[model samples]
Target: MTVPSSGLRSPEARRFLNDRLDWNLLRTFLVIGQEGSLSRAAARLHLSQPAISQALKRLEEQLQVSLVIRRGPRISLSSAGQEVLQIAAELYGTVSRLGPALEEPAETVTGRVHLLSISRIQSRCYDDFLARFHQDYPQVELEVDVLRSSDVISALLQKTASFGLSLCRTPQPRLEQRLVLQQRYAFFCGRRHRLFGRKHLNLADLQSENFVSFTSDQLGGNLSPLTVFRDQQGFTGRIVASSASLDEILRLVDCGFGIGCLPEHIVAADVQAGKMWRLPPGDGVSDVNVYLLWNREQKHTQAEALFLERFEHMLLTTELGERF
Candidate 1:
């Protein structure tokens, strides 16, 4: 491959020069480029600012190029730094693809792991999982992104994410899926609503009530649980408002706009605080099954495997997992 014009002549020459280059120095340089400050990059990499500065200096000496321009408290990438950043990212991707062939011991599975999930799952379910993972695998750098379920699947397919958590599973031959949990949903209303204090309430009783709808990418299309439940119950209530944010849904419900169907975990605190009341059990509302998805074609990194194992263990053995 032809090398870019970053004071480098040929690929073979660059490779020969890079023989003495340290991987840690490259990592430090990339982190500095991302954070744009030695202090911030040091904090992220769990090193002192002076150590970070030394690493950058060593990297510059090895490459024989000025990579960054440092000001009072800020740093900007030089043209050479930008070119090296792109090449370093490509190198990182190549190393990541080596997967289990490069696996070290479980305790030393050190690398970056990219995970994608829906907003609800990230906020409500994976917080504790993330904490435990970080505690056990301190060397592993975890990166997470919250996106829509469809977008999460797309990221997995495009190999942009290592794994994804989604609400629904699609039939793709090239993708593998495992059911993470089955989340039970309940109808909720603000404490001040007419049905808040009502006992023995059922789906029929909510027929004419206004409803707040939260959008989701379901199997068929973009539809809200309220819409599905309404159709299932043959209820004719109108949707007073719609939003994609769970916080907005709660706010709208708390303001007495309308009742909404939400996962039990989401409204648990609200229920305990008496801000929302759960309607009695009914048939229209159904449990949602969440799945973990990954590309079957990609090899699993040791860190990714460890994360999956710990996540599954937490899901099956913990209180949060028991709730499902």
Candidate 2:
């Protein structure tokens, strides 16, 4: 049934009329508009190309408007389609918010929250926050996947993850981000290394040293902390080993293969036990910002809100806060 464009005055009446529109059609329309191609939209929606085309046709018929202009394999929104797109986005956002806005009391909240986070965060702070959140809301399931920073953003964009924690900044306008923590990355060496116990060392002193480096892929071709430090210090060193695994990097450093750059928190225990030594000042090391990101289109459920609150509190009261 088509919702007539006239005589809907009350908010509830508008909502009722909106309910008459096929949400599947609207979703398909939005995806096609965003992707600008039926095949891409079909891939994203996991539907056949012809099915996506049919849904768009049906949506235009229901709305009584020519929503798109098709030329060969390309698609572009008509003026009317642009207006409809705006309205559809607003409607979709409103519908998403409805669940949390009308949710029951906090104690009764239940459902799973899927979270994607960088592996560094998983290693450093995941356990403390997960344990605390579980203690408060035992019935709410929390599913977490540790991925690279780029993968975290990808999962958020795909809507496969409700929330993301990333070590890199999210440049996408569609994602909302908040600064979660600041982590200091410093150079470290095994106790057996020549410069391990040095009180002070110039940047040039380490120019010819071999280094165990973190993989550059996680940063999406952007500079890593080590690269940034190298540029700033004009060091001409070669990476003797590189890996995506932080454990492997640490092990390589501990075995006296080369100096490794890592977050201070990850190596605090090793430093305290004299297994490794942090390089002194003048190394051009700096703190990197970590961000918590989520799609603005996603509504917060009561359980998700509670989890965020608890997680924020934990971060504020712990060593993460101190580092920040």
State each model's CA lDDT, in order. 0.73, 0.72
Q: Candidate 2, 310: how far from true, in Å?
A: 4.1
Task: Write down the lDDT that model 2 would get.
Answer: 0.72
Clashing pairs in 1: none
Model 2 lDDT tens row, 166-215: 86643676786655677777888997788888876866777778888877
lDDT of 1 by residue, 78-152 (tens): 889988876775666556446534556446768788988776663445676687678767899989888777788
TM-score of each: 0.59, 0.59
User: Where is model 1 poorest over a 10-residue stretch in terms of lDDT?
Assistant: 315-324
- Sum up the clashes in candidate 1: 0
